[model samples]
Target: MFKLKRKIMSKLYTDIFDLATAKVYAVGRRSVWRDYFDLYFILKNNYIGLDESLLMTETRYGSVFSQKLFMEQLAYFGDIKDFSIEYGLGQKKIDLDEVKSYLLKVVKNYSQSHV
Candidate 1:
């Protein structure tokens, strides 16, 4: 049981990350989106808390990584496996291409030093 669970992160965390952190400020808040489908990328490779693992947060805000910078770091994990855009009540079209590869890489690279 422990070994099985160890390899799995959890869909629950993915949902929270998408709901709480998925947004773009490249221009403004109105344009950014965090739809449900996009959570797959974050969940698949465990990027939910990559910044914390990497110790990339800024001292002033006490945040390991910003939304934009996070995705920037997500490029190292692998490649764009899958993606989708959702539109509905409280839903926005989220993109998930290439995020898994980058995030998995971050976890592998950083989890070691932190532990």
Candidate 2:
């Protein structure tokens, strides 16, 4: 039972890490604004590095993950229009433009260093 419990706990931690990493990597690939919002907070909290997140995302998504498309998507956010905003619990509201600006800057910095 002890060994089984340990295995379960280890898997749980790995799953949690993978989920968080995937969320961070989902920023550019997903169309929903919440993806970007979640990434803003994830990055704000320094949960994971962009490259590490991408690697984990690749593990989770296999070849379906596209770095080229992800970079392209990160470079733009014109599709997300202004809309009603809501935050859960203690979270505070943030402007859509602010989120976009933050993400764009992140991508720009990442691009500069990676290139």
Candidate 3:
């Protein structure tokens, strides 16, 4: 009976650890949308004046879906910086007041239309 109990407890612990590890992995992973936004910002900055080849290297992970979303946002915002405003500026390396103003107008228009 004791041996059976020990085996059951061990299985339970193993299951719990598996769940915890999965959660940890999920938390550490960046969503594809976030990756697209990072790439967009990098491109929008003219690759920070870096060589185009280097910029291409940075965008190596971009998939078809990410590219499509990036272009859609570009069309909607008319500028990459303005689209970045919607994602919050915590990750942004530069601040452009004009972009922020434009983002405000876009958000206002969107809100009004949805109402």
> CA lDDT, every prediction?
0.41, 0.73, 0.39
Better of 1 and 2 by lDDT: 2
Q: For every model shown, what is its TM-score relative to the native structure? A: 0.25, 0.73, 0.26
lDDT of 3 by residue, 1-115 (tens): 9999999989976654443333222222433323334333443444331133223323543442242232234234332332233545575454545444443454455456546
C-alpha lDDT (0 to 100) for residue 78 of candidate 1: 30
Shift in Å, residue 67, candidate 2: 1.3
Instruction: Give lDDT tens digits, candidate 1, residues 1-115.
Output: 9866754656655544443354211211232223222333444445555453223233323443364454443433233333434557885444354444444555466556557
Candidate order by decreasing TM-score: 2, 3, 1
In terms of TM-score, how similar is model 2 to the real structure? 0.73
lDDT of 1: 0.41
Pick the lDDT winner.
Answer: 2
Instruction: Decide which is better by TM-score, 1 or 3.
Output: 3
Q: Pull out the clashing pairs in model 2.
A: none
Off by over 4 Å in 2: 1-16, 24-29, 81-83
Q: In the order shown, what is each candidate's alpha-carbon RMSD?
A: 14.3, 4.0, 17.5
Candidate 3, residue 9: how far the Cα is off, in Å:
0.3
